[model samples]
Target chain A: MVSAQPAGFGHDTRHELIRFENVSKTFELSDRTVRAVENVNLSVARGEFVVLVGPSGCGKSTLLNMAAGLFHPTSGEVYYNGSLVDGYNLKTGYMTQNDHLLPWRDVVGNISTPLEIRGLARGTREARVEQLIDLVGLQGFERSYPSQLSGGMRKRTALARLLAYDPETLLLDEPFAALDAQLRLNMQIELLRISRSLNKTILFVTHDLDEAVALSDRSVVFSPRPGHIRHIADTPLPRDRNLTTLRHDPLYTRMTAELWDLIMPTLQETRGEAS
Target chain B: MTNAEIGYAPASDEKVAEDRKRRMDKARQARTRERVKLNLIRLLMIGGFFALWEFASGRLIAPFFISAPSAIFRRLGGWIWSGDIFYHMGITATEACAGLLLGSVFGIVVGTILGRRPFLARLLDPIITTFYSLPKVALAPLFILWIGIGMDMKITFTAAIVFFLVFLNTYTGVRNVSRELISILYLMGANEMQVLRRVVLPSAITWVFAGLRISVPYSLIGAIVGELMASNKGLGALLVRAQGEFDTAGVFAALVAIMVLAVIFNTAVRLLERRLMPWKSAEQELEGAV
Candidate 1:
């Protein structure tokens, strides 16, 4: 029944921001079909930081796409704010793996793109873009093109651009996958800071175990291939989280090991099936 | 609000910055000197070629068969002195300009439309390829027959040639546009028209400029070919008349004029390219390429 929602069977429907109604997506190719995700029943409550953790090819990104209204479930429905998401959802901002920053645009221009698209006044757009640039610490790099920016700087610019339109929710799909370890760690810290300051609902997708455990209020662990929500575990880490120090915390280490235990079997099963 | 709030790169050794500037200056000066030397060598090579041609025209070969550069220069001078070249050049330039504008618009539009519709493009690909393969010059006679041997025929023929050159370039541009970029914008609640303007147009314009660079010269050539095939007013007609009279120098002079026309068209396109795609750094552009 529609009332029987995951983690919220008795809770009021008003608090639920997004709900997946028995969602399944089967992508048909010329010769075969790829069942990307199956029977994905989930509910993201308002202001909840839900991180989807899975191995590559697990359709974690597809779930994010479904939430953003880029794709519809082949079998079921995706409801956002009590309405079916039939088209591109305006309430969410998606930061894809690729920065997707317009190469022709400088830092300022790329940050101001969403505002410009929304047809905001020139002065208002400029003021907002300036504020975002400052927020993301891209002050001196305003004139620099994406090509001229460092990898870390480019990711920061993307973060600012995502914040430019001021969406209520953020769907970040493998946003820091390409960054080096140090940069990735720094961005993870930056994301936590930004997400806290803005209090935005974030549906973060990453394969990285540490990232999932470090950032999420509730970490949704997924199995390989046809992605199934294997475990929905609460992170229960302190709100004032410093990742550098938190990585060594007793709870952080234990959560990560538990997540790996849940994930390790799927990897072995995939290998078994392949062989 | 303050820089101290975020991680800083720290002062990157002022001496390193100064040294970098100095090396850049030296490199620029070295490049300037090399260019000067290159120009000097080119001048010598051209002068030697002319000297050989001048001597050989009368001594080793018949001046009738191979007109001297001096004779071509005289013919050009005569055209310049009489101001008769203005008449022919003005017509040719007009045809080329008209053709460029009309063809570029059609090319950009058709190419962009095709780019957005994958199935429609796939259905039309075979016919489109066939048309693209059809040599544009082969259409001159048909265009002349249909439109008649006037400015109309020349302009139409020129536009036909330009369309293909620009069409493929823009189509390729549209194809290469990042789909993820469009998806990102769509997620931001940008409409189809806004996506077209913000993502598609900017991505395709770079290719349009490339197409224009290649198309500008062809546009002029198309006009000239049309004129040569029929028309009695343009510079192509002048070349034909010279050939009829066995005026080798006149033929050479006409060719020289066409080269000059091509240079002018290319320079104009370059200027326009500078204006439209200012994001493309001039230093990143090929130093002396068309």
Candidate 2:
């Protein structure tokens, strides 16, 4: 059960970093109105990794955008640290599905952009960039431009850049969706390790049920367009779970199965419409 | 064992080495032959063109108007021998280069300002369109009347022509930057100026270079047309003088000089593009392949 916290105050302010209080979003096009999400209430605790899985066009990304302060909810409010997020939230970093790496800059240049914006000293920036490059397994590609990099390598650069300014929370929208299966698994493992080590809160959006189970402390499933939360299940796996061995864990399997079962009819309806 | 004894054993490394060497030699020979064939065809084409021109000038048309290629080359050689062409060339070059530099700098500054201020850009869109629609070359005479029949008029006209071309491209380039990228930067705590410097400017540079590349010939045309209308010096003046005297060879010589200058200017911009935006070139190649 989710409790409706007050707009300005929460009982446990220390743990709850991001709160959506009955948030809804609608787009008013020229001829029609599209209700993207409806009356969704959720809270992400400090250092918690939460994933949202739903059917296509189910407004998972919209939810993340609201948390990032890039979009305002139609009716309710999104709160960050017990304050209404009215403008751009500086405490969080957003990584979209597209790498959005500055095409003109090389890997090191792109990764160090946030530091440069903050006017960090040259030496310190270089050192931090070097560490991130090493962390992302992009040591040899520091001087290579984004256009020259493969999809997975570009994703790694994006991840490094997102971590550059050390935002307390990460808002990622299917960052690894473009990667191959093996690379996706590797990135997931790396992400889990990094999140645990840094203790950063993360709100991830993905359509993949298995990824939701493998990456998140809790998985939230939603119905199709005008999306609302259908089920919220905590992963039964341990905190230090390995991505490679997650499929074999009974809890991971059961959690993914439960999520799939909840969203199956929506997915089939979308598929039927497409066909 | 019996088959090996009858010379059916595995081949020695020396035989494989010989085969590889022969293949490489054959490939080299083929490449040389291809180069020679291409060169020969090019030579034939040029020679045939000149021979045909010579025949047609005397038979099909008046030799007075369409001077033969030999006469054109002779006039070109005479200009080189006398050194008068250099002075005229230097004047035109100064006008074109100065106008190009000044106009590009001005265009980039104004375009960037307008691009960042969407309110101003929308307000002035119609006025900008009207100015752009006015025949720029037709204003050369007006510039001559205001600035006098000197190099100043030509330079100003050239700069005016280059300005519009670069401005529109730079503005579009800035406006075309992805909204998603801007939002990401904002979430990263980038203020307006930081966003402009780190994202908008660098992203617009490729378009700026493209505009520069296209403006080279227009800049030359602007200068030459201004000179032809009323100027004491420049290749365009030389052409006008030759036309008045009915020296077709001199006219051809001046035209050829302009062509050569255009080629040099184009090559310089291309080289600068390669050096300055190496990433863009690589990106273009990837897009081409896709």
Candidate 3:
């Protein structure tokens, strides 16, 4: 990683990058209306790592989609940098479970895609792509296509691509959900190291409570369907703390237990309704 | 590791390399044997069919109905020596290639625009369907009436036949490009043009190439049939001429020439496919329908 300089993109004294004000989303399917999320109000500050945690189909992902401006809130507004995200907020980089790393392109081409889109000078774009390739530890696999690479390697390519253009915020939807346990842990640690050093505001959506505890400045736990905030707990773990040893920390265990208690009742209640 | 580290022995590593090479050589030999067996089977089938036909040509069945392979090859050789087959072949190839290239360009451009704009796609859907439903041979009389019996008329007919196929395939391909991929680009500060260039076109190109491969034989059919109907220049005209003279061997030779030409055109397309889409193998391309 070429030493990340936050001064390059020019962030002033403003703190808030994303703010969801009473945001509610209702999806109109063919047979039924799906109220994905209801009245979710949360603000993510600049350089903050916020993880949205919940059970599956709990609309945590819907909120991330809202922040990315893929879809608007049906009721209230979602804002970025004090402006309403009317359509396709161009300031964010999004990565989902599937790498979407264009099977046609090799790794270098995929990472350099955003830079090419922005029409950066060829030499500068090449240099940045080179730096990103190193950042994601994909140096030797630069010429390898996504289909040829392993799952973990493809995810790394996608991450390198997301960082190539240097978006102010990253919207990740369980980006490592498909990986094996050890690979997922390694990716999590690497992501934390990069995002922390680069000062990226990340809103990561995950169903795993352990992951939420491991990688966030604050954890916003959501209820079951028609998800709204169940609790917003500040992790307050040291940024430089080693994740491999962090589970031993009493604060980490206590917070995980507390968040678990908050989520269990909602899960049981939903299951009871289903039964 | 202890012995190698202490004494800097290269023998163990050399032995590992030799074992790997031997395994690779055995696999290569197996692959070659399989391919040779397949080719031998193909050869046997083709040769057996031809030998049976040759034996029956004059003895059981009348040679006039189904000429012997030897007689057909002799006629083909004479035509080659006289240099008439080359003329017909050149004219047919030119018309087919010209029509294919022109039709594909129009199909890709039109299909892309309509695929991107659903409103326009819907507005013109009925007319496009009607055009597609119309038969290629039926339009020959009208094409002759409009442009007359030159090479242009044949090329136009071929292009028209090719346009609809290429257009439909390209339209379906472009429409089915992953929404997630497009949205990701949009979020990455890509404009509509950038998104199309970066994602839509590349994604849809596999479809475009499929259409092109399908259009190759159809283009040849278009030119040959048009020549058969009116023109004096192509292999189709040579077939018509042989039929008029009641020369069974000549007709058989011309048919064989057409078959060879078809094979050549198809091979060209496969080669071009390999060049254009290095990322995908021929079999791998047929996936991603959704």
* Model 1: per-residue Cα lDDT at residue A199: 84
Scoring each candidate complex against the real one, what DockQ results? Answer: 0.39, 0.30, 0.36
TM-score computed on alpha carbons, candidate 3: 0.91
Question: Global CA lDDT of candidate 1, please?
Answer: 0.83
Listed per candidate, the RMSD to the true structure in angstroms reads 4.1, 8.4, 7.0
Candidate 2, residue B153: lDDT: 81
Per-residue C-alpha lDDT of model 3 across residues B133-167, encoded as one tens digit per residue: 88989999999999999999999999998998899
Cα shift from native, residue B121, model 2 (Å)? 1.1
**Total clashing residue pairs per candidate?**
0, 0, 0
Q: Tens-digit lDDT track for model 1 on A1-275? A: 23223453223366888887778898999999999988777888777788998777888889989998989899889999989998889899998788899988888999999999889999999999988877766767788767656566778899999988889899999899887776676677778877788788899998888889998988887777787777778887976787777867999999999999988988887787677
Off by over 4 Å in 1: A1-14, A269-275, B1-40, B118-135, B138-147, B282-290
Model 1 residue A147 distance off true place after TM-score fit, in angstroms = 1.2
Q: Write model 2 residue lDDT over A129-153, tens digit each, in one string.
A: 9999877777667887887776777
**Best by the TM-score measure:** 3
Off-target runs (Cα >4 Å) in candidate 3 are A1-14, A273-275, B1-33, B282-290
**For model 2, how does the per-residue alpha-carbon lDDT over B20-123 read when each residue is reduced to its tens digit?**
44655666677789999999999999999999998999789887888989899999898889997888888899999989988898888888889888999999
Span of ten consecutive residues with least summed lDDT in model 3 chain B: B1-10
